[model samples]
Target: MSSVNLMAREVAAKIVFYGPGLSGKTTTLRKVYETVRPAHRGEMMSIATEGDRTLFFDFLPVKVERVGDCSVRLALYTVPGQVFYNATRKLVLQGADGVVFVADSQAEAMDANRESLANLEENLLENGIRLDRFPLVMQWNKRDLDNVLSVEELRRELNPRGVPDFESAATSGRGVMDTLKTITRLVIKDLRAKRIVPPPRPAPPPPGSAPAGLEAQLAQHLHHRQPPATTPPASTGSTAAAISATPVPRTLTAPAPPRVEPAAVPVVSANTGSKVLGPTSALAPGDLFDHARAAEAAFIAGDYTTCVTACTDAVRRAMAFAGEGSLAQQAFLLHVDGSDLLRLQGLSTLPQLRVDDAAFALYVLMQVFVRLNAVGLPTAG
Candidate 1:
């Protein structure tokens, strides 16, 4: 089952990799972990036998994109493939939002693949999830091996429902990311359809005849501490009627000034030992100042939970302001102290909020504010 934490603005979904023994489920998962940025992924934990075969399951936590303002965290797991470990597989499959069936491509492993597929279906049924209706992705792994089954034969034998399937050589990382991406999309789509994750809010209307730009409107709302005003529909009546209407649009002859792009701030990743630009690196310092002030005020008021939540919202709003061209679009991991932003978000959802935790979150947010300030806002064009 997927869980949504409104306070943290996060949605978490579990995805399990299930396949026959030595079918490359663990290998596929490792490839995915390696491919993702270190800041976006947590440590991968594996419980395996002496022979390196998965005994229990491998767990990897990955933070992906946002559904609306909520970040989507995926818990990727791989079950032991041996028939004797069916109980372990069933346990891991419980509460799974999606599954990746990694079928061995060798012709000799057809029986193992079929049995594993049956076992998976049975386990999912036990957990109240119908395999046919559930989000699933099929991976014909080990394509580099000799005497491998063709994709067509594998599909006919294993994937009768014709779900999204991919051919892959997991060891060399061929098609592994493709399989993972498809399953993610399918799971998120399913979550949206079930209303477990809210659909993205519609984009606000652009500034029209109003003199104030969108940023100004945001600044005003943040500073004035008032509810955001809704954009009223255009009037189709006489000028007198339009003037008499409530919240009428202001007519301006001059065009809105062009925005100035701020200097990029380089963030060093401790895990990867790489320097990548932060997502809001190009935004003016003042762009996020209002949010920082709000967070600080919350902390001063001794509202620890609200302080943490405000910090999370500050980061989210910064990413949203960065637009689609920013590095955040590629990975949601805001590179402040290597996922401190995400950790701060998790802290906001704690049942017993601590003052120390809230203070640390505000400190991290201020660090971000300082970095942006150091670069200084460029002159408006």
Candidate 2:
């Protein structure tokens, strides 16, 4: 998938441009690429394919006004406009905050235009991205051409939903900024409407713990108790040669310790369960991945205890990682973010979460391990 970043107060909205090849999908992108001042735009990226044709995608991070107490940004992207690159297109649309459909306005290209539009919907459906909910815009490009269809004809044949449409001669840069602004406005408007982004969440008073704080304690416990390394058996010589040569016996030896090694402390934060900082967050992308891998491993091994504990830990750490009004913090609201994850993980038996961590606080973690059927656990035998 492609990533685009736009900044407005604190929100980051990902907008994707979808359309047919040569329909100005790339041209619209090029226009945005050419129009936004260098300081305001991120580098443009295109994946080159056969015949010098390329798949277009871009990311721009720009901060707009502060909403409430924080600032937001958005990422803009364009799917490869080629028909055969549907796989890449579908992948790009995942997690898209909004979309802009760029259509060819020439009269003869109407069929290609229709097929491409239908493809967009189908691609969206295959990925479980709701076409209706995300902000959608339509642009009929190359309008400067002599044979271009009228806006009313374009509306009747395509864009029946009346999404905000633009007429553009991308080469000359007309309607480019307006289109960008329109999409940005729509993305923000949708986030506010869905209430996905939240207001700032304040941190709790700092705990007066030692250097071997909760996190340090956890790493010490896990690493210190790790099982001893095992050695592989030494390979014997050829059987016939061994028999004739009086069978030299050998003892297996453990592999040598690495010369330069990373500290053995655990990557999982005792404070932060999963880092709330998105791609640009405090924790590295690899660290977030490590947390996910660890949690999945624990869950798959029927170690729900560890999974529950880790989830709780993730919540706590997210507190510091997700800034005030960040989606990382605000979206943790039960029914929105954490609820579905917990239910999917078979932790629904747990009660409501404490605000301290993702759902890691004292109240939720305890119920995750407790079973309703285990009455009088000691007397069960």
TM-scores of all models? Answer: 0.60, 0.49
CA-only RMSD, every prediction: 14.5, 22.5
Per-residue lDDT tens digits for candidate 1, residues 1-381, read 899865455799999999999999999999999999998998999989998999999999999977676789999999999999888998899999999999999999999999999999999888887899999999999999899988889989998898999999999999999998899999999998998986543443354632245434533443343222345545667765555554533222224223211222223443565654332332325666555555555543445566677677766655544346553441233334534665675675568554556667766666555444444422244
Clashes of each: 1, 29
- The per-residue C-alpha lDDT of model 2 at residue 8 equals 16
| 190 Cα displacement, candidate 2 (Å) | 1.3
**Model 1: ten consecutive residues of lowest lDDT:** 257-266
The clash number for model 2 is 29
Cα lDDT, model 1, residue 381: 47
- For each candidate, what is the lDDT? 0.73, 0.56
Top-scoring candidate (lDDT): 1
Displacement of residue 232 (Cα, Å) in model 1 is 34
